[model samples]
Target chain A: MVAIADSVPKPVARFRFILDRRNVLGSIMIAPAILYVLLLVGVPFLMAVYYSLSAYTIYDPSWSFVGLANFEDVVQDPVFQQTLYNTFIFTFGSQMLGLILGKFGALVLLRPFPGRKFVRALVILPWAVPIALATVAWQWMFDSLYSVINWTLIALGVVTRSQAPNWLGTPHLAMLSVIVVNAWRFFPFAIVIFLAGITAVPQDVLDAATVDGAGFWRRNYQIIMPMILPIVAIGLVFGIVFTFTDLSIVFLMTMGGPVGATSVLGFAGFQTGIVSGDVSHGAAISLFMLPVLFIVVVAMLRFIRRREV
Target chain B: MGSGGNKNNRSVTRRSFLKASGAIGGAAGLAPVLSAPFVSRAVADNKSLSIVQWSHFVPAYDTWFDKFAKDWGDKNKIAVTVDHVPVQDVPARAAAEVSAQSGHDLFGFNGSGGAHLYRKFFINLADLVKETEKKFGQVTTIGKQLGYNADDGSWSAFPDFYINFPGMYQKSLWDGIGMKPDTWDNLRIGGAKLKAKGKPVGISLGHSNDPSTTWRGLLWSYGGAIQDAAGKKVVLDSKEAIEAAKFVAALYKEAMTPEVLSWNDSSNNQYLASGVASYIVNPISAYRTIQQSNKKLADDIFVIEPPKGPAKQIMGAASEFYGIWKFAKNKEAALEFLKYYRDHWPEAFKASEGYNNPCFANLVPKPMPILANDPTSTPPTKMAILQDSDKWSAIPGYPGPATPATDEIYYAFILNDMMTKTATGQSSAEDSVKMATQRCEAIFRKWARRT
Candidate 1:
């Protein structure tokens, strides 16, 4: 016969017992992250919405309600409309260029070439570098006076010194230049996504396609691409969100210059709200991005859900 | 046998140790949390002052300023913190501070200061301005226009220094071309000739302070005004403005490269210093920068008054001023520091190498020491032309106080864009004027309602 104390089971500590509940433990683990998002992101987002509907400004920190007046003003302004159009063009143009570059990059990196690891690291440098730092470097490269590209073109005798293009000055070229920098910045991330999606396509499927006499291009286009469509679409969605809301590239490179030719929503919002101290209109300009962003996110997510095999 | 028994009694388990340590840590942390308020209050009341201003365009000025501030703090028995933000980021940083209702005690503004924009957030510096005036004659006209609020008859901020916008020209380049950019017609004709030879005059047309100031000078010299003298009306749609816009367009086509459309405040400096630009309208900082880096290039650079327009020769000046925040913790200390800084204005002027002109009439009296006797300048009298810069200098809301609406228009880059659009062939001069007028009216109406 065992003693009474030895026969009974040991009591767990109260804290441990509480933590043993899955719900309690899960909530405790995620509490900080949830709190951070709520306080930093959610609160500011709600404040922005409130500001959009009010006559708030840095000078006059009042919250007197103004209804849709700010939005109405923004809509009527031709510059805001131009900015909206530019944002779309910048987003889609850069996305297409980035995706194409990324796809080709993935194909090239898929092979087991010598020094593959070094090459891969070099390829990721653009995305790995901070955006502002990279953009500043690009700004110098596209500089009106000191652009290396123009210097090279002139040295090659392809263009005369007088004919060297003002990369950030001409309206069309300014837009193109910003798009190229942004695409270059983004292609590395796109390549990573492409590689992951492409790698996920099994050897079995490729072997089957090969046995069925599918050439390399046919195999990639018909068999593997269909399976990786969901991932690629998801990547494109992220690219859209990022490129659409970007401020650094446009701000540092062109400053929406040559007369608002390259102005995007983000930079415009900054110019109006922060620089000009007109918080209400700035908030309104920023909120204009939400509907489009929401639609793209939701549509892409739905597509991803349906296409996932 | 007795030592082993004692060791066994003294040994502690991990859990028991942790429990004891946790109690000790809790008490240690609780002491600070409990006393933080009282300690902060004590520090705020009499011990610390903070200052935030732009990183000066001239690096040496910032070096001198930081040391001066530190020495002052040491003498005063206060812990002083000075933060230098980039010029472009100043407005946004100030907005953030105002929004949070907390930040540095002394806020410095470059170029017109925008005291009118955030007047409510700043304490009225009338007494301080009056006291300074007693010591050093009356503040200059443009200084009053920049800092004084006519509505309440208060000086919302204290004018510190004014940066005169003179034409910085590559003397060798202009000499080779046999032209002097003393008048608008001469700049156009001579600039066209120079551009044909692959060297162009570079006045910024970008959305930067340089362009903003340059265009206003042009507008004013052409007899155009953004607002009437009373600062109560938008007069940007005048025939003179249309002519000014057209003149810029012709200048862009005939005399300037598209590069001017992309220049920032520093670009013109870089262009002229690189020995490429024939002429640019800017402060003396550009020449000073060359003086530091390349003495030979500095020798070739010369200063002249802004080009003469048909109507007048007025040019816009960049103004620097300081304001004490109403919510500042150590207001008295901040005021004291300003007073100290004010008393030593001549030293500040020397540190800036005469780039900063005193706003007070008598602080650095006639023949202005630095401008009169400069070792670095090519002739050692190259900068003496700036002695009468105040005569040609006009604030942004010219002929009137720079009001909140004018401040808004300035920050929004309305005038800059109007000139840019017309120059770039994006819009007709008339259309650009119309668009700018509409924008100005909208801003004016918004700000007018508050007044």
Candidate 2:
């Protein structure tokens, strides 16, 4: 009876066996995701590239190939040049502040303590809340005339009526204020990532370091930092991307002002391309950030993969 | 065994049929998705006109506008939907519409400049303008400049109204300083004294419509025009322009606090109503807001003529326009509605609490009942200045035509930045003017070359 059963044909089973190969199965599983990216991301990016090269406005469907004219306009214009500098300042400033604040927060929370969960919850508020709501609230807090901070300072006799600082008025102060607000909103995310990385550090290794008379600073600087380097690198990459392309905070707070002092490339692009009716020029301005971002992401990805290996 | 084998075969065939049916249904789903536009077009062909506008600062204005449109729709057997969004978001929303190439049939912008910005997307309304003007007198000088393109003689929009920007000041504060702020110098003098008394002047230096209005008034008074009368060349680098820049900077330093640097359109209203500032250059809406929020403060609020400069006293206002998009399914109905509304301007103007100043001079009658007596205003004549705003008021690119280029400069807050940069001491007045001139030139060149 067993030999007779084995002689039966199974055409469906043979076809299934071919599809079940690892490479074929993997590709089939990811087909939907790949198609989604192609339709949404790839096509739009290509359209943007085309728009940047050609004379195109939203109203017109036709385009005459203007070559590098938009890019030329962008490069020669002093406003776009300032925007590039501004993007660098905002991204670098906010990311550095976020990393430092996040590490400090994670280290403190890493320790066993009371209300630790509650403290962590409060720390997560900025990350949990919506960006627009949080940034608008910050705008009120940093008002030029009625700043709550200045009111507090005046109450404490720290400053007089005329001596109070204008947080978002002066150019440098406006840039600083935006960076601080941005860092405040983003550091919670970094802290969460760093906390997980810190927990992954081996307990035996820390105990061994303590046994060797390693002090607190030595343990963190020499031992823990190197151990979390890969994770730190990932966090830095995320912070850089987020800060570089950030739109809401700068737009809401200073509107890239006190004389376009706070206008990053993203906000400038929106103004030029969409609001001011210079779409191709806007695309060109935005594309300037791509190569630098790509290189940074690729380098970080390789570093991540090497560590994993 | 035969019966069991038959049952298994039937189940397999049934499962395969279900699988094929599911696949076919999924593929068919894409058909509707692809043909959605055509179907919508068919459905909307007979649909009533739709309008999108800024929610008026005065709640009553919206109530009046919405009801008026609905009534007109009822008479014409059309369904009218008026969607009022916040004024600040009007530009972004317009941009979104331009990008999608689909939106409200009749979109209303807070300022006339928006029509110029997206001129290509609008229907040519030259004939409609001529018809409306014949019914109502010649549309005011501003009405033509705001709604029509000079080069092609095409009307891109129909000018609906203009909101006035007058001097809104605290009566007691001004009396104490013994200054009426009748001149630009008087504002600076009074504002400085008031600042020392702990209540500074409130005028925005940020990217806001109010700032653009205020600065333009100053620039125009100083004989500084953004462009020549033809709107062809950049002329912001004049000696008068630099003088205006310096004067504004001195005012900022001596009188206003840094708060003005961050003020949005509503911030000054809030500041004045909060009693933190002695004076704010704004529309009468600020005083009205105070009337609702604080009656005591509202009583003290008095609006006078806009401070004068050596050149002239120009009210920096952009006429609000209602434009019909070329892609509109109901352009014929939209044009009909617009003509009817303008024909019935008297009722609309009175209903808007004088918030909607008429574009046609024929609409303003002698003894202008609304301005002479207002139940909401402290003094009956407090709002009278608004009735005559058309006399002194001119849009941003005054002396020159309000072209797309001028509108772009206003929308971009170009003048606001120049004033702010100088005020904050980031750039010298001369240097700021030079930079602004360069920017204005580039913008002019872009639009000039395009046309």
Candidate 3:
């Protein structure tokens, strides 16, 4: 042991050697990024946790430590429960629909077809549009009186002029509209990811599958799908996270209205924290989703590992 | 070997000391240097004054602000710029600025209760009032009328404009019904007739941000008060309130379309513009929009004082008041700009093009004639609605002081749940009121202590 220690050299000497010119330069190069994350992200995350445990108002200077009172209140609050349920519905509904549409869209575009490139380009239009402008356009399309949809329906004689439906007035319908809008806006991302995944599937595998007498759907399900399952899962996770936290669509479109049918966790956080000036409650509401989010992330990681195995 | 080792040790010590000291210095110096730009920018920009006020107030009062800015710049050697933001963003944006401890010299908000809710961020205009009144005769008259004593001089805001939310209808439609709506009960009958004729009457019954103003207007018209004079209690569950709720529910059942539950600030205007509805309980702003947007309809539209209820005739007052930021670097300039705005009322009124009526009774002897000839103004009848506004206007929190909980209850409970449930027939009017009252009492109790 003494001989090995002597051969290894003194701790100070080892430290000096590790901090030699090359390593020092590398450390210096990465320092800014490290410090940036530490200051901006790490500090704020710590502060958010601290605030979640306290009763703080931006309007008032006095911040009292309320322990788990805010969390308890959030659990008891009916609005919070409704918002949580809406958030889950919005995220899951949009992600599933988006994935299916995106996958199908990518497959359709993959085949040599007329105006394939143009169609692919057009597919991205919804994603390209600004949320505010898109929401406003949707608002016009769904207008109770002058909606294009209503006009079209009336013109087609599918519905009488007097029977024009109020698309955003009904509670269930409003939730459906928001989910549809969210799916429309985010589905292009899924399409792009799935397209990349599909492209990565070796042409040799397809040739082999064809030689094995596998049909198109059979080949897709057996070979292409298993190969890209990880990517699809990744896309699903991202979609769920984005939809769960989104506020602009619901805020600008329905404002969590039509009797709070569209209210989600994100909207509740914004209203409670920013609008009502109850920062603690808002922080608490946001933290309410942390455990669920953690579970999803862990599940996603486990799924990816299983896929690798 | 000894010479080389001593040389290495000297170099290492010097380098280590330099690096440690440099890091310490950098960390220490970072905050001030980074903060300098913000501080210097604010100081350098001190000569300039920025205002976020109602759209009508800025455009209508354009010549006044322009002339005043030029004159004030020449006289006081300070440049001033006025900007207009929509009315809805005024409160939220102002609150954000206050939180950031920056932005805007003068910010205008909707009502007295709103002003009080954000009182912590505002400078007491008492000193400014003395300075202004000494220079100009009176910069604001409504301030005095609203119990803001310019003599004792504890004013925080300068009252700018006033609006009344009463029942407005298409005069042609009402005339077709062969009955004029003179009382509050007349709304139900007229609305039913309109519905029979295939038109739904539009009324806002939602838990929107503006619910307090909209629903409170209906409540007061029915002789319901949120509280008595002291404002220290909640009286929203009173018999009068229940009666008003029942009446509203009946109106919703008979005449109003399902869309009323989804209406927000722009819904009433949209309803009138699209001709989807014939009558609505809304502010003059809606009437002004219709008049400007569609002249043909403007001629047929008539504004009526709120219908007399079983107990009284009441209307909700929608007004904008100006307050200087307490943390403003240029408080004197902000006050001067406000004074200049007030002094040039005639030009301001002209600029508003009859959209905004001055709250100061003296500045506006009567409503500005609707500029029907100018083609930009709403029709003559639309402009005539201002007269009705004067007769029946209740300030928010009227009969009592406005509380945050009062606004919250108005939005969250009464508008969102009770109104929707009542309209949808999910709950009876009494049950809706009962649920709303229970929720309101909880909120009021929580916030009353805070106030």
DockQ list for all candidates: 0.49, 0.41, 0.19
Docking class of 1: acceptable
lDDT of 1 by residue, A188-219 (tens): 98999999999998899899889999998999
TM-score of each: 0.93, 0.90, 0.83
**Highest DockQ: which candidate?**
1
- Top TM-score hit: 1
lDDT of 1 by residue, B106-147 (tens): 999865637877889899999999999999999998889878
Stretches of candidate 2 exceeding 4 Å from the true structure: A1-19, A58-62, A305-309, B1-46, B74-77, B364-366
lDDT of 2 by residue, B228-302 (tens): 887678888999999999999999989988777767778898899889888888877788778888999999989
After superposition, the stretches of candidate 1 with alpha carbons farther than 4 Å from their true spots are A1-14, A17-20, B1-46, B111-113, B172-178
**Candidate 1 to native Cα RMSD, angstroms:** 4.1
Candidate 3: which docking quality band? incorrect
Clashing pairs in 3: B60-B351, B60-B352, B184-B307, B184-B308
**What is the lDDT, from 0 to 100, of the residue B401 in candidate 3?**
51
Chain B of candidate 2 vs. true chain B, TM: 0.87
Candidate 2 fraction of reference contacts recovered: 0.39
The alpha-carbon deviation from the true structure for residue B13 of candidate 2, after best TM-score superposition, in angstroms, is 12
At residue B342, what lDDT does model 2 achieve?
A: 80
TM-score of 3: 0.83
